[model samples]
Target: MHDTDDAHSEQESSAIHEPRLWRDKGWTARVIKNEDGDGWAVEMIRDGSAEPALVGPWTMGRNKVDPKPLDATAHQTLVKTASEVIRRHEQQLHAQLNKQCSIETESGSLTVRLVVTPDEFEPFGTLTAVDPFGDVIATVKVPPDFKLTRTRAERWAADGFGRIQ
Candidate 1:
């Protein structure tokens, strides 16, 4: 037998389309009063996220006092823009937390990578050395702010992958 509770929950969470609010396709867009000025603003929040993914100015309607009502095309555009904003934020975060460099040492050529773990109390980074065959030779924990430049990597390799001071 089908679960009535599940069906009721689905109905409760279903799409909602109103003049100033829209909820569909895993996103919710709501028109709000602009905190900075007299005009209005809109905020798009992804499903299950506590904060809005994108917020920006909203246009006024023909009356000039009421904010423009959201439509299908506007919702789609807002979804695209919010998704792009989230994508760019993720890319920038990954770039900031990960770094890589290649260096030729006396032993051989190796690729070094620094992966940072952002812990609340004690953040740290892991330095890993990979051989040409894609095998990890060594890994050492270092400060989260460790700089993994080519010269630094070469020096680390020269030191036989010892713990950096």
Candidate 2:
């Protein structure tokens, strides 16, 4: 009987430190009152990131005046959705930052790569070409806003890989 009580007390103590507004598991889900109107919103934040990865409206209670109270099932569902949001955001960012395409040069087929560096204040990218033997043929700095597309890359290769104008 004493052991059972001790285990229960231990679980209760651990729960005390849990955040009321947030839950963390390499990411966090936080509930907040919606700013625009009557609903609620949940914000998903990844660890070490300053911004929320996702934010969406929450459900309303039967009364229609207040948000449905968050419970274990709702919290679990929110966490799963939030996790996917972060995963998709990461994939999109990766795709934007690193792009590669192949072009047929007079010499041979060359690989073109566009890698972007995004920063808070300034953004920039590099366009690079590699020969069949893995030798870097040309490298150019491009504006961060540069978009890498199949047509644009092909045009660059056909134009002798010069600075994009």
Candidate 3:
């Protein structure tokens, strides 16, 4: 869905020569090539529900006249270049939202059922457990990006049960 207008704006925003990839730490990335000029472009990905934040042209080599062609090395390099951008953005976003919650109890880890009801009046998540008795044991509001990993699930299972705080 991107066109020339978007490209111009994205490049203008990041107009300085970033010699080191890790110098900027406020963006995430996807390495790409500008089809028009056959040059490399790094699409800066940002944290949250928003789409790609920025996109810009990258230098080719020492000459600077010919842009670097997008290949596996270039792609990986750009990804490495933007790693800190993604990380710092994620940290800032997490700090602002404070989006983490867990419940420990004595029985076994109950599944967290995040009930996202947009009632206009009560705009919140009803994070309850998917237990057999169908009782909503706990509730909290967390960012949508939060996830329950398999390893954590295994740990919860190992404990055999308890309400987490």
TM-score against truth, every candidate? 0.90, 0.64, 0.30
Worst 10 residues of 2 by lDDT: 15-24
lDDT value, residue 101 of candidate 3: 35
Model 1 ranges off by over 4 Å: 1-13
Model 2, position 53: C-alpha lDDT score: 72
A best-first ranking of the candidates according to their lDDT comes to 1, 2, 3
Q: Please provide, for model 2 over 1-165, each residue's C-alpha lDDT reduced to its tens digit, 9 standing for 90 to 100.
A: 699799767655543113335453355666688988778887877667899878888777798866666555666676788778878978999997999988886788889899999989988899999988999998888998888887888888888789995
TM-score of 1: 0.90
After TM-score superposition, the amount by which residue 4's alpha carbon in candidate 1 deviates from its true location, in angstroms, is 15
lDDT per residue as tens, model 3, 1-165? 479778767756764333333212334454456766776666755434266545677666667655544454554566565566667886885554332234444664456554443445654443345554666554555334444444443454454424333
The RMSD (Cα, Å) of candidate 1 is 2.6
1 or 3, which is superior by TM-score?
1
Error of 1 at 28 (Å): 0.9
> What is the total number of backbone clashes in candidate 2?
0
Between prediction 1 and prediction 3, the one with superior lDDT is: 1
Q: Each candidate: what lDDT?
A: 0.94, 0.77, 0.50
